[model samples]
Target: MKAFNIEDTAMILIDHQVGTNTWASTTPLELLQRNVIILAKFAKGTGMPTVLTSSQETNVNVQGPLMPELQEILPEEFAARIKRQGVVNAWDDENFANACRNTGKKNFVMAGVTTDVCMVAPAISALEEGFNVKVVCDACGSTNQIAEEMSWRRMERAGIGLTSTNAIVAELVKNWASTAGAIAFPLLT
Candidate 1:
């Protein structure tokens, strides 16, 4: 409803792992990757508190490691990523949810590997917990279009705002001449 202030907003990226991403079909993989990278860069450049999580990453056959670019872009946050053991809803995992809580931010900007599963639950859960949440739509994908649309509707019904990478960048940056804008504007192109 209101603009996201950098001081009050935190980024939560869930299950953007290699294996899970391979199954994403709703959005093209290459575009998803690029959008996510842009988000990561914006978060890093803006000094936003970020929580990164993975589901069964060590079990490469399933969830594999998180996108390597995350490490390259936000190494410190990547190193502190929450590794959940097959938790479908990242919010269900105490550590992951706590990590988000610990950020002391009331607004969450989230994106994940699979829209239907990984993204929906956590977004709704956060909203239910009174957090203002906005899911980066283009930055998430699902097994199919049907699943993606269903998940989007579900989140919408639960009051979780759906947003896009470009929209978020614009919202956070606000003015190209400002400091954060100067840092984040280039990532859009």
Candidate 2:
């Protein structure tokens, strides 16, 4: 496979609501939290443009914490590189889609809660649209191991690169000396 073109890459984070729950996971929720935070670190560290989306979060309160961290992570010195959208798929919402189109990227990087729906939907949509998509599997969780595995198989069939959060950091860093690599290694272990 050809190397990912980082400059043309965009990160899309879906439905990491503040109180979201994953029913079955070999990786604990805390680890999922840590992995996601580190994933954001990779995005900021690499200067990758990102789109953040949450669905029906108005009724639920599972989305929070990550926003403030991004500001500190990126330092926002190069203009805000992240956009928040009020959509489920993140690709289906017009604002999200427009934000993605505005990024001029061919690659979409993403992680989300409830891999069955939240993550799977946009990933499938993007893959169908001919976007080179990478779904960060480790950064997401499902109701159970069976669901997670099934979702993984579904994504794989779509020709999506189902990767881990650590792999995503590697994709962005491509070098250990980079700030992302330095920060990512400890958290992932």
Clashes of each: 0, 6
Per-residue CA lDDT of candidate 2, range 10-74, in tens?
87777665655343264587778777778777676567887766566445445433434544554
lDDT of 1 by residue, 54-131 (tens): 999889898799999999999999999999988899999999999999999999999998999899999999999999
**TM-score of each candidate structure, all chains considered together:** 0.97, 0.80
TM-score for candidate 2: 0.80
Q: lDDT of candidate 2 vs native? A: 0.70
Candidate topping lDDT:
1
Q: Which stretches of candidate 1 lie over 4 Å from their true place?
A: none
Q: Which stretches of candidate 2 lie over 4 Å from their true place?
A: 21-26, 61-88, 178-189
16: Cα error in model 1, Å: 0.6
**RMSD to truth, every model:** 0.8, 3.6
